[model samples]
Target: MYYKGVYHLFYQYNPKGAVWGNIVWGHSVSKDLINWKELQPALYPSKPFDKYGCWSGSATIVPGQGPVILYTGVVDKRSNEVQCIAIPANTSDPFLTKWVKPNRLNPIVTADHNMNGSVFRDPTTAWLGKDRLWRILVGSKHDDTGLAYLYRSKDFVKWTRAKHPIHSAKTTGMWECPDFYPVPLQGKNGLDASMIGDSVKHVLKNSLDMTRYEYYTVGTYIQNKDKYIPDNTSEDGWGGLRYDYGNFYASKSFFDPSKNRRIIWGWANESDTKEDDVKKGWAGIQADVEVTFSFSSLDKAEAFDPNWVNAEDLCAQKGSKVQGGLGPFGLLTLASKKLEEYTPVFFRVFKASNKHVILMCSDAKRLLSNN
Candidate 1:
């Protein structure tokens, strides 16, 4: 995916077989800022570090003696408490093609018996800077509420633990995927605009401005650098960051040190309308969007603003918007007929007996475009 000008995307795919057994990284590229083409797998379950499964992880290209990188914590079914780092095997396309080894440093971040499995998983690694060098946000269940762990890395290889989030009643739900960054606020004029992803169509459409936000899709993170305390951060009125309201979850934000700008992206959605991942042979999909953030002050209120750009803007198709019947929606029929095989349109649906269900795809997406 190309952001601003440079292209970037790391692959998250299962390698060994069709099952979620061994996950590895795949690579891709683009130039005109939107179009992208598939490349090969970048990181895979290799020797000491990733033998179990490469699992899910993000990429950080920090200024090192050369290029810097850190990803997730995945353990094979064979061994427990396994933590390792994989070096980029081929620097040509760093996003794809990686070689693994137990960190010469070994477990830059490790799990403790005190910590449980629900948390302590995938690490979204990014370079904040030299002093704030490497910042890793790992899924964690430190307090009763779900949270993430933060670690700082000065050198590309060595990492020091940093502040962990203190939860609060600011929002509901356990924190998992986490992202932190500044957004461009709209000029002091009208309702500050922020692009919000539509859960109904599973694509991001512009929505209201957000001063602070958090979610399960991007997990959760603390916005204020100060007032950050490590232990027992989950307290009432403790204050946390959420990106948007409604069903938008699992959002990840990044700051481009070079541009002095902040940007965010998220899982387009959490679930695929009751379709079984085990059966579709594919699990979750990254929302397929790259958001651009700009700050603004409106109504005399000061706030950080985020503007979202979606696939609808990139690989979006322009045709008569399809309208279907209105009710609940589902995928396959009890008779085992596939929907996508039939038409490229949205549906209006209703639940029926256990087997025979009817889906109408021609009359109701417009609540107000009614004729």
Candidate 2:
């Protein structure tokens, strides 16, 4: 989130090693997004509420309060996830270095009797509604169904779960790092999470644990009814619109009031095996890339096969080398001089009955050598 003329980034980090473990909220700040200066770890397993681990969550700048973080805290050995709140010890400090978790309301929201505690986690950035209440969502699942549990609070401290989830879908499995926000219907400008009206459409994004990919839907948020109805423009579950067709998960977006636009980022897990990571001593890297593409026409785009339901499978079949009228066209990154070891990041266009479907592939199939 952008605050006090600086952009703060908090991520899941394992201070001890390259692989994931000993989770804590790693902190970094940047004047420009390109360069960052590391700060002391923001939140760790210091109190009983987060003793086991401190996991993913988001930050919201409250109206009166300077800034608050709502994160998933694993309280015990069973991996029971609960929503917890933390505030900057010194809000006046532009960097907002130290933090304090109030014991009175540390675990502000927990799984109800019918819900599974282990799978409940990742609170989104809270937003205040027109009705004078703060709202947030915690991701979870019931059996084969994914859920975004909604909670409303008059005061930021005390929260109550709604009778039903704001939204859910069967077979999507556990939804991690669920995000809810609003965007303008006509322009690139992003609406604040609290914004409501016909001029804006709300978005709900979920990271599917079963598939290890993130999917999102543009829908109408019926605030009075506390329900979300997705438009029929795309599928609601497995075969839905993805933020990225490649290795991306646990994405969170924040409205940058500075730029009047929303920014999103996600984690890309290591492509290599666990053994390879152990050998390398480092498992992953954080990166950001933006690309622009232009095509003369879509007249010769391949006819999208109806059987191509799974995008990853389709990308594997029609890779970057395969020719197409409009695509299989994009950049090759991390390449060798001979171009034998490069990762192809490209897009392919397929013609459907009424519209054109664009498929993006960041194929890392050749990242490693057999030997």
Candidate 3:
């Protein structure tokens, strides 16, 4: 959330190790998204409500309250996922470095004993309703049916379960990281999540744990009935429209009041092995874009070309290097006029367990002058 000209980002982190365990709320602040400064863990395992772990959640700026957080906490080692809240101890500090979770109001929301506690997690960022109440969605599943259990609260503390979910789907499995928000039909300005007006539509996005895909529906939000009905064109099942066809999941969207636009963020799973990730000391890709390259004749380079380039020498060089096992390669380079100094970029393909694997590299050692 953007507050006082600074952007605050809260994410799930493992304080004890580099891998996922002992989860806590990791906080960071930045004026621009490009550069960031880390603060101490904003929220962690505390009180009986969240003694196990402090998991995924979001931040919101309320009217009188500067910033409020609603997160999922594991109450016990059995993995009982319960919703909890944390408020800033000092709103005067723009970064919101300190947060206090009152013992009395610790577990703000919880599932019934009959429901599966393990599948109930990831509370959405709460939104104000037209009835002057706050509403939020918690993701869960009944067998293979995905569910977004809706809850309403006059005050952020006390919440009551709605008779029906805001939305649900069959055979979608667990729906995690459900997000609901409003967008104007014809303008760049974003509407508040609870905004009820004509000229506007609501969006409901959910991450499917079974498919590892994030799907969304854009349609009308009936505040009077407290239900979300998708448009005829919008499909709700696994084969429906997805936010991304690739490795994006667990996405959350929020209104950027400063820009008057809504922005979304997602986690992208990497296609590399776990050992490779551990060797690199990272698990996911920050930028989930696939870049392809080919050579040009004019300057022996095709700048930013998405299609495959035509480079005979590069292909020959690669084929010879690989002993005719793999073909159809290309060269990319930026060289000086005298050809004395050059930087060559290339890709090599190899057959790995009946699948073609690509190894991308820049031959700086072979191209650059030793001196």
Candidate 4:
């Protein structure tokens, strides 16, 4: 998160070993988002609340209280998951290098006897409400149902679980790393977590532990009712739209107040064998950033159909002659250099009744090699 003049990043790490066991939050700071300097572990197992391990959570900046971190902690050897909080040891430190968990308020929220303690983890960033209460969510599951449990606080310390979950889905298994925030309905700018109005919409994204894919829905937050109702544009179940079609999970997004945009971070699982992982001494937990480029094989194929064209010439068009309205625009690939065989892989955005629908497709037909 960008705070003060420095960008602070807190991530799950194992200080005692290279592998996933001895969990703690490794802290790092940067002036520019690129180059970073590592600081001491921001959070680790110390008290009874997080004695076993320290896990994922989020940071929130309060108006006059500075930044507070809400994280899931393994309370005992049984691996009971509980929500906990940490405060900066010195808010004056520009990097906010040190943090301390108050014992009195440690393990601020514990699972009820009827709730499954093992699956509860990953609290989202907290947001203030119209009722002057601070609210947050913790991911959990109950007998094949994924849940985002809601908890509210008056002072960001003591938390009380709501009568019902903020949201849930049956047969989806556990929901991990749940994220909730508001976005401008018509603009690209991001809204603060607490922002609510007719011009704004809320998005709730959850990483499905069973499928290892992140699913999100654009919805409305009925503040008075404390419920989220997703628009009909997307499904809110296991078969819903995903953040990525492949290996990405436990995603987190934060609004960049500085840039007026939202930034997302996710972990990508390694497809390689375990033998290869131990040899490398690490697993694939990484930031996700991708880019794609398209080119035609034929130099003069400007028809924009399944015609062959050189990639260079197509890119040279610079979108000058391209018509734009939720484009399925992209280059036709696997085409013969003579402008013969090709396939189009593109994305189209459609205006739905309540939201925009994006569809990606690749057209491959039986084309004789001779052609």
Best by TM-score: 2
lDDT of 3 by residue, 211-232 (tens): 7888888888888677888886
Q: After superposition, how far is residue 28 of candidate 3 from its true place, in Å?
A: 1.1
Return the candidate ranking by TM-score, descending.
2, 4, 3, 1
- lDDT of residue 348 for candidate 1: 29
Per-residue lDDT over 1-371 for candidate 4, one digit per residue giving the tens place of the 0 to 100 score: 77887888888887655456888899999887789899999998999899888899999999999999999999877779999999999998998888999999988999999998999999999999989999999999999999999999999988899999988889999999999999897978877898988989899999988888888889989987789999887678876767765467888888778887788878877666867867877786665335474535323222333231222233333322344454546556558885466665555444544554444444455243564
Q: What TM-score does model 4 achieve against the real structure? A: 0.80
Candidate 4 deviant stretches above 4 angstroms: 285-371
Clashes of each: 35, 0, 0, 8
Assess the local accuracy of residue 307 in candidate 3 as a C-alpha lDDT between 0 and 100.
30
- The list of candidate 3 runs beyond 4 A from truth reads 288-371
The candidate 2 region of ten consecutive residues with least summed lDDT is 362-371
- After aligning candidate 2 to the native by TM-score, how far in Å is the CA of 1 from where it should be? 0.9
Worst 10 residues of 3 by lDDT: 297-306
lDDT of each: 0.42, 0.88, 0.76, 0.80
> Can you give the lDDT of residue 221 in candidate 2?
96
Per residue, candidate 1 scores C-alpha lDDT tens digits across 169-287 of 23333444544322223332211011112211111111111312342222222333512222232222214222443235445444444444444655433344334655566655543
Cα error, candidate 3, residue 225 (Å): 1.5
What 10-residue stretch in candidate 1 is worst by lDDT?
200-209
Q: For every model shown, what is its TM-score relative to the native structure?
A: 0.54, 0.91, 0.77, 0.80
35-131 in candidate 2: lDDT tens per residue? Answer: 8889988999988989999999999999877789999899899999888999999988888888989998888988888789999999999988889
Q: Candidate 2: misplaced stretches above 4 Å?
A: 291-317, 349-358, 366-371
